[model samples]
Target chain A: MDCLRCAYCNICPIYRIEGWESVSPRGKIQLLDKKLSNRLVKDFYKCTVCGLCEVVCQSKLELTRIWEENRAKLVKSKKYMPAHKKIADAVLLYGNPYAAEQEARVLLNSPSNVLYFAGCMANFKVKNIAECTVKVLKLLGLEFKVAGKSEVCCGSTMLRTGFIDVAEKLFLKNVKNWQKMNVEKIITSCPGCYRTIKSNYPKIAEKKKIDFNFEVVHITQFLERELKKLDLKLGTVTYHDPCHLGRHSKVYEEPRNILKKIGYKIIEMERNRDFSICCGAGGGLRAQFPEISEKITLERILEAESTGAETLVTSCPFCVYQFSKVSRLKVRDVVEEVYSSMREVELKI
Target chain B: MYEFPNVRVEVDPEVCKLYRFDLLKVPKPFSAFIRTPLAVFQPENVKDLLEILKFAKKRNLPLIPRGAATSAYGGVVPLKRSLIVDMNRMKNFEVENGKLIAESGAVWFEIERKINKKGYALRVYPTSALVSTVGGWIAQNGYGIGSLAYGSIAENVEWLEVVDFEGLKKVSGDELKFYVGAYGTTGIIVKACVKLRKNNPLGVEAFETSIDKAVEKIDNAYHAAYKNAEKKIFLLAREDGESNDLGLKAWKERFFPLTGYKSTFSNFSEVIVPIESVVDFLSEVEKISKHYQVNFARGEATILIILQSRNILKALKIIKIAEKYNGRPFGTGIFFKRKDKDFWDFKKKIDPKDLLNPKKLKGNLILNFAGLIAWIA
Candidate 1:
């Protein structure tokens, strides 16, 4: 790609916070083009794969695809980072990237053809998001099954870091489990999982000659389709578009429309929609570069704070996790916001 | 023999390689390829920059001052095993009265956002404003976006703080003009005070018309718009595509659909000409495009022409046509064809060793030829 260096790096979180071109998208592309030694492998791992670079790219370089493919090539060359290796090992050993024993955090009250795939983050890390997701599903009066402990890591971290072999195994295992459940539809609250399962899974299935019959949808898309209206009013809040859900999956309007239906005033961050900044929690960045990830998260929080909104709402659990840790403003997942509003209506009765 | 500050110079090959090229948007000719710099020095503040400049002068090491490295003409490309002075870390900005006094590394978009909050905006900014540094803009003396009204960055600049072997000096007016478009050949621009105007959104109206009609309309409408308008009227015409007016509307609505057009190995030319000769200039552009079998269009102004073609020869032929029509290529440093011996003389006095961006004086002929050859090869 002929990089015009339009200076979109100015908006890139990793480049802005780290203050180095080596970690910037342009620098990474240069390194890839030169096919340099493993010395710059760490630099490639520094990106959050938030798709901000691709969105603002004047050349519209398929940067995300390049990054992922290069990352996979790096893994094949055995030049991948050790931190990413650890996450891959965890996924292989425990069926989850977190290496925790799988347990049903929220049990499904009734089994249905529709499966709620509460991803690794929602299942173990952010339990509230999983609970709220279930509550929202129930509030909408839809019979859905929680995959619970049956859900393996979607291998998003592994896939993003270039461990395609390991990710394929996890993808196969998840697909097998879904097939056994006989689920017709899969809904995920995590954008990372949503994107991987919806977009990435079919490719792997096609290659592996496996039948991946289930249709996948994010919680926002699911809720937008099922729920008629949310009557409660939420005060002015800013929406943070999770990188995967917004840019990766092209699901920008569903969450906003859901919020609008609830009578909430939405203020936009300067960087929103496809141009939305990352919470610095994706693409295995937080695991490999925690300090840089925290700095990026802080920047996103500051952007949210700039809007003077009382709350920051996001559709992805990972974004909520990152924003909640740093932002003074209340960070809520779209599901959590919907559930809370539903609960408020019940209390009024 | 001079000893550099321990934290200032980085000899790491990985780090140094990052500064080897700017965002020139074209492949370097095989012959023009330069080795990665021996080291990269990132200055955190003006004092650090001055010290580095002094050290580079003492050691007689060629130094290339870089800000965002977004120059389209390889102005920041390191031509030898030199020291690359990375100026992005020197970001410090403050507003005084109606002017912005900022360190060279201060990003244009960030400055725009900050000043915009105060009901003021930059008088002129590059199209790469999101990533271009204030110092780089001044150093390159760029003209873009708002130049139709405010003129080039050099015109909008109130003052500039530069440092070389001669130490620091704040120059304004005619002296400041020496640094504008000089690249870093004169001296390293450490900071600048740029003029600002009240932040008023310009009303953009797109018309579907041929290049001839568009040029005529812009000439008449621009005059009327400039009479009392806070912001200058800008126009864009798409030559061979679906209506760009709809595309512009989509962009304004923040739902930009990806267009199938990819500018691969395309030749682009931006030229400025007299306002009265806009129609004639456009006719010449059309003639060149037809002769070369390339696509050409006007953007925002009659003088500004954009040409896209996979054939490098056609693109080169178009550039020649622009020159024939008295159209000067627009860019920072030596990208433009302007010959100024006085500026070079002044540059020699300030940078006696020519340590700062020594390759800055090279014309676009070599660069364009290199792109053409690379594409053909």
Candidate 2:
């Protein structure tokens, strides 16, 4: 694709705030085409892999795939940012990037064929999202078991940061654990985990020559199918599209459909669907450049704030966590919002 | 070693290579004219820009000023190993007394948005407004969607702050005209004060018609709207019916497609004529296209008679026909045939060394030669 340098890609959250061509998507592509220097390597980590660039791309270039591949090349050459190394170490040592202790495994060994992989974020950083997913699954009367402590990092961060070997190991371990459970379906509230398991894991498994089974579905997709089961009356709320769920996976409609069925008035942000901005927490951005990450997050919150919606609903736990940090408006996972509304209606009945 | 005050100089071969071309829609042979810059510079303010100019002048290196690089012609394309001064970092916008005071690099769309929030809008803007910078429009002497109502950027601009090797000077009236369409030959426009209108709703009407009927239909529509004394009417005609939908989408998004089939090399001609001569000029274009066996499309696309041909000779023939009908190439840059002798004389006086965008002074001989080669090869 010809880079017109039209500055249409200037709307990127990181590029908009940083105001440097070196950090912009078009700039990075130029840098990659020429050669990757230490500065270019540092700039690559600045991207959150939001996929906004790909969506707005007039050439429809596979920018996300290109970025990921370049990142892998950088990692192979040992030219990656130090923060990525720290995350890799933490994931390897603790089975999570957060470096929390791995308590006794909470494998229920239930006879249920469904499994809820809460991921690392939902497990520790945003536990309410996990509990809410469990409660909603129970409310639906579906037999499902939580991965609990047994679930390792889905290796999304490792893969995104170019630690392919580390990601492969984690992928194999997670697949083996799930195979032991004999599950037919896996549901995740975290878009990172859902995207990795549903998309990236298959590629990794094929490379390792491992047979992987079990259908992977995000909670939004699962809840969308079971939307008729719940009775809810949610207030006017704006929905934030998680980059992983909306752009990477093309799961835009399910979350919006679920919100509409729950009786909430969906006030759309100016940038929605494929054009939605990132919540500034994905692709190891929050880990490597927290200050830049916060600025991007603030910009997103302001966009949501402009909608005048009292509540901001999303399907991904990472987006909820990031927005909740700086947003005055209530930030919630779609499952949590629906579950609470369902419980309220039950009490009223 | 080169040094400038408060400016970041990038000599990275990778980054410097990207500045080699603007949005020039020419065939591959013509692309050979694009020359890579020796280095790229980002100046933060007028002071930095002045210092860079001085530095370039002392060394006698060609200095090319770039903003957004959205020029349909090779306005910002360097002629040799020049210093490309990217002006995007100097985006400072302020509004006072119904006037927009913006730095040259301030994006036109961003300025429109800011002023819109304050209940004001720009008098005129280019179709490429989303990515086109205020400085670029001034340099290119642009006219677009609202030109029929507000005239060109030259008419809308009130004052300009221009920097040359000598120093900075405030130019207006005739002096400002030198910079418009001069393609940065005289000096660099660092800041501009443009007239703003009250944010008024524009009534847009789209219709489908054969190329034969397009010019008359659009002219009659404009007259009819004028008779009604409607605030303003923006008329756009596209030869491809399918493109109308794409145009509408672009209008809604307020952005031009950055990359697409349109970005490919082609023989594209944009000609502007007096309202009375538009029909005649378009008919002539149609005749030439048929004679040359060129796959041509003609219509009133964005207040100009745009004739596109797949064949290079056919495109050149159409441009020649447009001149016969008293039409001039639209926009002020390398694409157009006519030169403003007065502007050139003024540019000679100010930029005596002609070290800024020296390619603008080179006649269309190179383009003509390339077009001939393209037809043969």
Winning candidate number (DockQ): 1
Q: What is candidate 2's CAPRI-style docking category based on DockQ?
A: acceptable
What tens-digit string does per-residue lDDT give for candidate 1 at B1-377?
A: 13654446667788787777775544434325566887788888767777787777767889888888776566777766688888888899999987899999898888887778888877666666777888887877776655555567777888888887768888888888688777777788888988887876544454434444544554312111111011122343222223356435522522111112333334445455555555565566665442111111223232333345544455445455555666555564434444787877787777666777775665667655644564354
lDDT by residue (tens digit), candidate 2, B238-307:
2222334533533453343222232342344555556566546655554543211101112223222223
Misplaced by over 4 Å in model 1 are: A1-10, A33-35, A109-111, B1-8, B25-33, B219-263, B287-316, B332-338, B362-377
Error of 1 at A113 (Å): 0.6
In model 2, which regions exceed 4 Å deviation?
Answer: A1-7, A104-109, A205-213, A228-236, A260-264, B1-5, B11-14, B25-39, B58-61, B121-123, B148-151, B196-209, B213-216, B219-338, B371-377
Error of 2 at B29 (Å): 7.5
What DockQ results do all the predictions give, each relative to the true complex?
0.52, 0.37
> Per-residue lDDT tens digits of candidate 2, residues A1-349?
4554555666677976765567878778767755666766687688998888876664467888888898898888888888889989998898998888766323444688799888888878888887888888888888888776778999998878789888998988888888887878998888999999999998988888998887999999988998674435556899999999998899999998888887888999877988788998889899899999999889889989988998999998899999999999999999998788778776888
Pairs clashing in candidate 2? none
True-vs-predicted CA distance for residue B173, candidate 2, Å: 3.4
Q: Give the clashing residue pairs of candidate 1, or none.
A: B235-B300
